[model samples]
Target: MGTKKYRRDTLIEAGLLFSLFYLPGYLFLAGIPDPRSFNSLLYNLQIWILLVPQIFMVIYLMHRDDLLDFQSFGLVRPGAKDIPFILLAAAGTAAVVMAVQVTIMLVAGEVLPEEPLWKLTKYSMIAPVFISSLLTGYSEELFFRSYLYTRLEVLDTEKWSRLIFVNILFAAGHLYEGVPGGFNAFILGCYFSFLFTRKKNIHIPAILHGLYNFSALLLTLFL
Candidate 1:
């Protein structure tokens, strides 16, 4: 038999996780007009810094309690057979997201905000955008998909409820983006979550997330 679940503490742990790490980080960066501000960068680096330890904590807690293993959490080391599938998942998901984003753009005919995101023009931002996208993609996916999904598993939430609620929370956490960003995040969360549930691999979702982010960065040229 497996270790007993911590069913009662599910919501408590979720609240604590958000309040302790994400909430403070969001508040710290709230007033910054530009995402590249000293404050914003600090917020970015700080959250990821906190996230590393938190990742370890979640892994340790789950493993110690026998609730998770490398395989269950999709932390398995990719062997020879997994690489191509992973690459295909990432590339295919990126293509789909690009098409969706472009459709949204066309439907709304919205003007791209001046100084959106990194404040670097398309030609000048290759390296910075790549770095930012990778970091955000990896960190967010690890937290939301890998860790939070596990947390939800111990709750009373049903399968569909778990899926919808998790995606909703993911969108809510993207509050920095205001309305449009929240919408985009919700859609991306659903897409990535679908992939995660299907593949049972965090790496798949993370790779796709990163690729999508990088492609979105490239899209800045036209926006």
Candidate 2:
């Protein structure tokens, strides 16, 4: 009975991770995180409310169940040798931004951001940008590449097959981004998966993922 309960709980937690990734979009679709009201503190607070709780739940459950740890979760501190790889990831992210820009131009012609791109670096947005980037970087990497990756590794499936399957879900989570964005995310997902496995340290991927995302937001919004 305990075994059955454990399996059931695991299944539910898996579903939660997928849901958490996609839930923030509902706010925009439902017009709850209304862009029109973004200047108001209340509107801004709504954004945080929508984003935070589910993520915290994932962390709490993972910790409580003893399913996560610094190493298993890819929270290891990097060795000096890892510096170049991390830096390379940052540089590669810039290239990815350029590629995505070209792809967006070709596919969508002009995919306007919900928020003003020009205002991304504004003083008011500094806090939001930092908070959102930090949350996205830390949470998504921990949930997807770290937790999901570790669980999937235990499956009898072939290695590449498992990685590809996970990448598809990761890309699909960003489906609201349109075809180009999804494609970009798919490629990025695959790359990060490869990095995570090869390095056996999620810190590099986390750093790379965070910087990639933060830069992608800026370049996508501005350039």
Candidate 3:
């Protein structure tokens, strides 16, 4: 039946999205260098190369599943009012996350690492982080929350189930950051998911994501 077929297709698409995002982190954990390392240049380049092909593959898969809508993937233009708020929220969220990170390090008596904090100060590093953040945040949101959540919504699924599923996958994708980072990412994913569900706009969440990364970049520089 068409109903059963639709359900099957939805499951497959969700699975693919989850795997595309998380598998790289798993590989990285198997032994990727810290982004602050001298060899981080080579490490980041390899990850970017791997990411591009997966991106195209996800796009194709989403298109095939009929979930590739403009708004869902953030292709829709943002309004002027949306821009300012998004930027402000992004900045605030980034600041808060950095504060928390610092507090944690202070409490643990772990002195901040001396290496260059941002990979973007160098040309080779800039390309990967910028492209990776934009693409990964935009595309992943489209696949996980926008496309997948929309389908789940139509299916009359429970709200909590939707939130948990999407958040878990989102967190799982950051597992390469280690257990602490993974836990933090998972918690943040839940917060962002709530924001998305309430606002029904990807700009807010995307800006928040960018802000978080930008904050981390600054912390590396000044901490």
Candidate 4:
């Protein structure tokens, strides 16, 4: 009876997270006429506003459930032993993202346009880039890998279904980057999810995520 109740509760929590958190953002992006043309600063600010509340909500929910510990979220303090793995994952992810863009450019026979995020590099706008990247990185890892994934596990969700559900939403969120970007995100999601499942640690992927976004913004400064 307790087992059944736990399963039911986990299912409810998973449903709520998907509906309240992921679906809204996906729908918002889908509803946008031209997200590319949207004001970068405004977009950055809007994201920060959205993410702050969402992060707090995650914290609140986890605390309420007494699942607020770092391990519960698949997070841990990085040690020297973990540095190489994190670096390798970050590099691999970066390579894959670049490879996709390069392949698309070569096939299209034209240079790809600048990323919308690159617009945030102006000194005055720079802070948002770092903050948003950091927030997005940890928040996404927390939500997808630690929270939703664990909830689904408790509910005995099918392995394939869990993978597809978590990754599709993640990839969908990157659709503003266009098809190539979405595809790239899906590939990275698989890697991060697998890593989290294997190591029970979210910091590697989270740090890599932030670094990837930070590097993108930093590129704008150099170029």
Task: Say which candidate scores most in TM-score.
Answer: 4
Q: Is candidate 2 or candidate 4 better by lDDT?
A: 4
- Please list the residue runs of candidate 3 whose C-alpha ends up more than 4 Å from where it truly belongs after superposition: 27-32, 37-48, 56-69, 72-75, 95-128
Compute the lDDT for candidate 2.
0.65
Candidate 2: Cα lDDT at 167: 82
Per-model TM-score, in order, reads: 0.76, 0.71, 0.71, 0.79
Candidate 1 per-residue lDDT over residues 146-193, each given as its tens digit: 777766765545777877887787887666766666677887898888
Deviation in Å, model 4, residue 3 alpha carbon? 2.2
lDDT of each: 0.66, 0.65, 0.62, 0.73
Global CA lDDT of candidate 1, please?
A: 0.66
For residues 1-223, what per-residue lDDT tens digits would candidate 2 score against the true structure? 2355666666677777676566455345423232234334454466567557755765666577644455665657668998988888767776766777777778778645565322343446545665666666666676778777766664334788878888887776666656666777888887888888877787777677767656644553454
Report how far residue 210 has shifted in candidate 3, in Å.
Answer: 3.0
Comparing 1 with 3 on lDDT, the higher-scoring candidate is 1
Model 1 residue 124 lDDT score: 53
Task: Identify the leading candidate in terms of lDDT.
Answer: 4
